[model samples]
Target: MKKRRIDIVPLTDQALALLEAIKPYSGHREYVFPADRNPRTHCNSLTTNMALTRMGLEGRLVSHGMRSMASTTLNEHG
Candidate 1:
Protein backbone atom coordinates (compact mmCIF):
# COMPACT_ATOMS: atom_id res chain seq x y z
CA MET A 1 0.00 0.00 0.00
CA LYS A 2 3.03 2.22 0.34
CA LYS A 3 3.68 2.21 -3.36
CA ARG A 4 1.84 4.70 -5.50
CA ARG A 5 -0.50 3.04 -7.94
CA ILE A 6 -3.26 3.87 -10.36
CA ASP A 7 -6.54 2.08 -9.89
CA ILE A 8 -9.22 1.71 -12.50
CA VAL A 9 -12.41 1.65 -10.52
CA PRO A 10 -15.48 0.49 -12.37
CA LEU A 11 -18.32 2.92 -12.00
CA THR A 12 -21.66 1.59 -10.87
CA ASP A 13 -24.84 3.10 -12.29
CA GLN A 14 -25.46 5.01 -9.08
CA ALA A 15 -21.92 6.35 -9.09
CA LEU A 16 -22.29 7.43 -12.70
CA ALA A 17 -25.52 9.17 -11.87
CA LEU A 18 -23.90 11.05 -9.02
CA LEU A 19 -21.05 12.14 -11.29
CA GLU A 20 -23.55 13.33 -13.89
CA ALA A 21 -25.34 15.34 -11.23
CA ILE A 22 -22.11 17.08 -10.29
CA LYS A 23 -20.98 17.65 -13.86
CA PRO A 24 -22.45 21.13 -14.14
CA TYR A 25 -20.52 22.21 -11.07
CA SER A 26 -17.20 20.43 -11.64
CA GLY A 27 -17.02 18.98 -15.12
CA HIS A 28 -15.14 21.97 -16.44
CA ARG A 29 -12.41 21.56 -13.85
CA GLU A 30 -9.36 19.36 -14.41
CA TYR A 31 -10.13 17.43 -11.25
CA VAL A 32 -13.65 16.57 -10.19
CA PHE A 33 -12.76 17.23 -6.54
CA PRO A 34 -10.40 20.10 -7.07
CA ALA A 35 -8.91 22.13 -4.22
CA ASP A 36 -11.16 24.88 -2.94
CA ARG A 37 -8.57 27.67 -3.02
CA ASN A 38 -6.73 26.28 -6.04
CA PRO A 39 -8.67 24.40 -8.69
CA ARG A 40 -5.38 23.44 -10.31
CA THR A 41 -4.65 21.02 -7.44
CA HIS A 42 -6.66 18.14 -6.06
CA CYS A 43 -8.57 18.52 -2.84
CA ASN A 44 -6.91 17.80 0.48
CA SER A 45 -6.57 14.10 1.16
CA LEU A 46 -8.35 14.43 4.51
CA THR A 47 -11.46 15.96 2.98
CA THR A 48 -13.35 12.66 3.01
CA ASN A 49 -12.34 11.90 6.58
CA MET A 50 -13.42 15.37 7.64
CA ALA A 51 -16.78 14.86 6.00
CA LEU A 52 -17.26 11.50 7.68
CA THR A 53 -16.29 13.03 11.01
CA ARG A 54 -18.87 15.77 10.50
CA MET A 55 -21.43 13.02 9.91
CA GLY A 56 -20.46 11.39 13.23
CA LEU A 57 -18.53 8.50 11.74
CA GLU A 58 -15.02 9.52 12.74
CA GLY A 59 -14.35 6.44 14.88
CA ARG A 60 -16.49 4.06 12.85
CA LEU A 61 -14.98 4.67 9.44
CA VAL A 62 -12.11 6.36 7.67
CA SER A 63 -11.81 7.25 4.00
CA HIS A 64 -9.43 4.42 3.15
CA GLY A 65 -11.74 1.99 4.95
CA MET A 66 -14.49 2.88 2.49
CA ARG A 67 -12.28 2.05 -0.44
CA SER A 68 -11.29 -1.23 1.15
CA MET A 69 -14.90 -2.13 1.76
CA ALA A 70 -15.86 -1.34 -1.82
CA SER A 71 -13.01 -3.44 -3.15
CA THR A 72 -14.00 -6.34 -0.95
CA THR A 73 -17.62 -6.13 -1.99
CA LEU A 74 -16.78 -5.95 -5.67
CA ASN A 75 -14.36 -8.85 -5.54
CA GLU A 76 -16.76 -10.99 -3.56
CA HIS A 77 -19.63 -10.33 -5.95
CA GLY A 78 -17.58 -10.73 -9.11
Candidate 2:
Protein backbone atom coordinates (compact mmCIF):
# COMPACT_ATOMS: atom_id res chain seq x y z
CA MET A 1 0.00 0.00 0.00
CA LYS A 2 1.06 3.57 -0.60
CA LYS A 3 0.10 6.84 0.98
CA ARG A 4 -1.03 9.69 -1.17
CA ARG A 5 -0.91 13.37 -0.30
CA ILE A 6 -1.44 16.72 -1.88
CA ASP A 7 0.38 19.95 -1.10
CA ILE A 8 -0.84 23.45 -1.75
CA VAL A 9 1.94 25.93 -2.34
CA PRO A 10 1.01 29.57 -2.20
CA LEU A 11 2.44 31.68 -4.97
CA THR A 12 3.96 35.07 -4.31
CA ASP A 13 3.21 38.21 -6.32
CA GLN A 14 6.49 37.86 -8.16
CA ALA A 15 5.71 34.27 -9.01
CA LEU A 16 2.32 35.33 -10.35
CA ALA A 17 3.98 38.04 -12.38
CA LEU A 18 6.42 35.56 -13.85
CA LEU A 19 3.56 33.29 -14.75
CA GLU A 20 1.75 36.17 -16.41
CA ALA A 21 4.86 37.01 -18.36
CA ILE A 22 5.13 33.43 -19.56
CA LYS A 23 1.43 33.15 -20.38
CA PRO A 24 1.91 34.61 -23.83
CA TYR A 25 4.39 31.87 -24.63
CA SER A 26 2.59 28.88 -23.13
CA GLY A 27 -0.99 29.83 -22.36
CA HIS A 28 -2.21 28.22 -25.55
CA ARG A 29 -0.45 24.98 -24.70
CA GLU A 30 -1.43 22.38 -22.14
CA TYR A 31 1.94 22.59 -20.37
CA VAL A 32 3.85 25.66 -19.26
CA PHE A 33 7.09 23.97 -20.30
CA PRO A 34 6.08 21.76 -23.11
CA ALA A 35 8.33 19.12 -24.66
CA ASP A 36 10.40 20.33 -27.54
CA ARG A 37 9.23 17.46 -29.73
CA ASN A 38 5.65 17.30 -28.51
CA PRO A 39 3.63 20.34 -27.51
CA ARG A 40 0.93 18.11 -26.02
CA THR A 41 3.37 16.69 -23.46
CA HIS A 42 5.26 18.31 -20.63
CA CYS A 43 9.02 18.66 -20.53
CA ASN A 44 11.03 15.65 -19.38
CA SER A 45 11.35 15.03 -15.65
CA LEU A 46 15.12 15.59 -15.89
CA THR A 47 14.69 19.09 -17.29
CA THR A 48 15.34 20.72 -13.92
CA ASN A 49 18.30 18.44 -13.26
CA MET A 50 19.76 19.38 -16.62
CA ALA A 51 19.28 23.06 -15.83
CA LEU A 52 20.97 22.67 -12.47
CA THR A 53 23.81 20.84 -14.11
CA ARG A 54 24.20 23.58 -16.66
CA MET A 55 24.46 26.05 -13.78
CA GLY A 56 27.26 23.92 -12.25
CA LEU A 57 25.04 22.73 -9.42
CA GLU A 58 25.02 19.09 -10.34
CA GLY A 59 26.60 17.78 -7.13
CA ARG A 60 25.62 20.67 -4.91
CA LEU A 61 21.83 20.56 -5.46
CA VAL A 62 19.02 18.87 -7.30
CA SER A 63 15.42 19.71 -8.15
CA HIS A 64 14.07 18.06 -5.01
CA GLY A 65 16.64 19.89 -2.90
CA MET A 66 15.38 23.20 -4.30
CA ARG A 67 11.80 22.24 -3.46
CA SER A 68 12.79 21.12 0.03
CA MET A 69 14.63 24.36 0.66
CA ALA A 70 11.64 26.39 -0.46
CA SER A 71 9.30 24.36 1.74
CA THR A 72 11.56 24.80 4.71
CA THR A 73 11.95 28.53 4.19
CA LEU A 74 8.21 29.05 3.77
CA ASN A 75 7.41 26.99 6.83
CA GLU A 76 9.94 28.92 8.89
CA HIS A 77 8.55 32.28 7.77
CA GLY A 78 4.95 31.30 8.32
Candidate 3:
Protein backbone atom coordinates (compact mmCIF):
# COMPACT_ATOMS: atom_id res chain seq x y z
CA MET A 1 0.00 0.00 0.00
CA LYS A 2 1.11 3.54 -0.78
CA LYS A 3 1.39 5.95 2.14
CA ARG A 4 -0.38 9.25 1.73
CA ARG A 5 1.12 12.46 3.04
CA ILE A 6 -1.02 14.06 5.73
CA ASP A 7 -0.74 17.66 6.84
CA ILE A 8 -0.96 18.52 10.54
CA VAL A 9 -2.56 21.80 11.49
CA PRO A 10 -1.10 24.02 14.19
CA LEU A 11 -1.99 23.05 17.75
CA THR A 12 -4.40 25.27 19.63
CA ASP A 13 -3.22 27.20 22.68
CA GLN A 14 -4.97 24.79 25.06
CA ALA A 15 -3.37 21.78 23.39
CA LEU A 16 0.09 23.38 23.49
CA ALA A 17 -0.32 24.23 27.17
CA LEU A 18 -1.41 20.69 27.98
CA LEU A 19 1.67 19.38 26.15
CA GLU A 20 3.97 21.68 28.08
CA ALA A 21 2.50 20.62 31.44
CA ILE A 22 2.43 16.91 30.70
CA LYS A 23 6.02 16.92 29.40
CA PRO A 24 7.48 17.39 32.87
CA TYR A 25 5.19 14.73 34.32
CA SER A 26 6.45 12.29 31.69
CA GLY A 27 10.10 12.95 32.56
CA HIS A 28 10.41 15.64 29.87
CA ARG A 29 9.72 13.13 27.10
CA GLU A 30 8.07 14.06 23.81
CA TYR A 31 5.47 11.33 24.16
CA VAL A 32 3.20 11.84 27.15
CA PHE A 33 1.96 8.24 27.17
CA PRO A 34 4.93 6.39 28.64
CA ALA A 35 5.70 2.70 28.76
CA ASP A 36 5.92 0.70 32.01
CA ARG A 37 9.68 0.15 31.82
CA ASN A 38 10.63 3.36 30.06
CA PRO A 39 8.52 6.41 30.77
CA ARG A 40 9.80 7.74 27.44
CA THR A 41 8.44 5.01 25.19
CA HIS A 42 4.91 4.50 23.93
CA CYS A 43 2.65 3.09 26.65
CA ASN A 44 1.17 -0.36 26.13
CA SER A 45 -2.25 -1.77 27.03
CA LEU A 46 -1.29 -2.32 30.67
CA THR A 47 -0.19 1.27 31.03
CA THR A 48 -3.44 2.47 29.42
CA ASN A 49 -5.45 0.37 31.87
CA MET A 50 -3.43 1.72 34.77
CA ALA A 51 -4.07 5.27 33.53
CA LEU A 52 -7.81 4.53 33.33
CA THR A 53 -7.73 3.21 36.91
CA ARG A 54 -5.80 6.26 38.10
CA MET A 55 -8.35 8.50 36.37
CA GLY A 56 -11.20 6.61 38.12
CA LEU A 57 -12.67 5.48 34.80
CA GLU A 58 -11.73 1.79 34.83
CA GLY A 59 -15.26 0.53 35.36
CA ARG A 60 -17.07 3.39 33.64
CA LEU A 61 -15.18 3.84 30.38
CA VAL A 62 -13.17 1.45 28.25
CA SER A 63 -10.76 2.82 25.59
CA HIS A 64 -13.22 2.24 22.77
CA GLY A 65 -15.97 3.86 24.86
CA MET A 66 -13.79 6.93 25.29
CA ARG A 67 -13.28 7.13 21.50
CA SER A 68 -17.04 6.72 21.02
CA MET A 69 -17.69 9.54 23.43
CA ALA A 70 -15.30 11.82 21.52
CA SER A 71 -16.93 10.88 18.21
CA THR A 72 -20.43 11.47 19.60
CA THR A 73 -19.51 14.83 21.08
CA LEU A 74 -17.85 16.02 17.86
CA ASN A 75 -20.81 14.89 15.80
CA GLU A 76 -23.28 16.59 18.12
CA HIS A 77 -21.40 19.86 17.87
CA GLY A 78 -21.25 19.72 14.10
lDDT of 3 by residue, 1-78 (tens): 235767667998998999888886788776777775876587775665677889998788777777789999989999
Residues 1-78, candidate 2: write the lDDT tens digits. Answer: 134666668999999898878977874687889877787898887989999999999899999999999999989999
Worst 10 residues of 2 by lDDT: 1-10
Looking at candidate 2, what is the lDDT of residue 35? 79
Clash-forming residue pairs, model 2: none
Candidate lDDT (C-alpha), each: 0.86, 0.86, 0.77
Q: Give stretches of model 3 more than 4 Å off.
A: 1-9, 50-60
Candidate 2 deviation (Cα RMSD): 3.9
Tell me which residue pairs clash in candidate 3. Answer: none
Rank order (by TM-score, best first): 1, 2, 3
- Candidate 3 has its poorest 10 consecutive residues by lDDT at 1-10
- Can you write out model 1's per-residue Cα lDDT over 1-78, one digit (the tens) per residue? 235777677999999898878877775687789877787888887999999999999899999999999999999999
Ranking by lDDT: 1, 2, 3
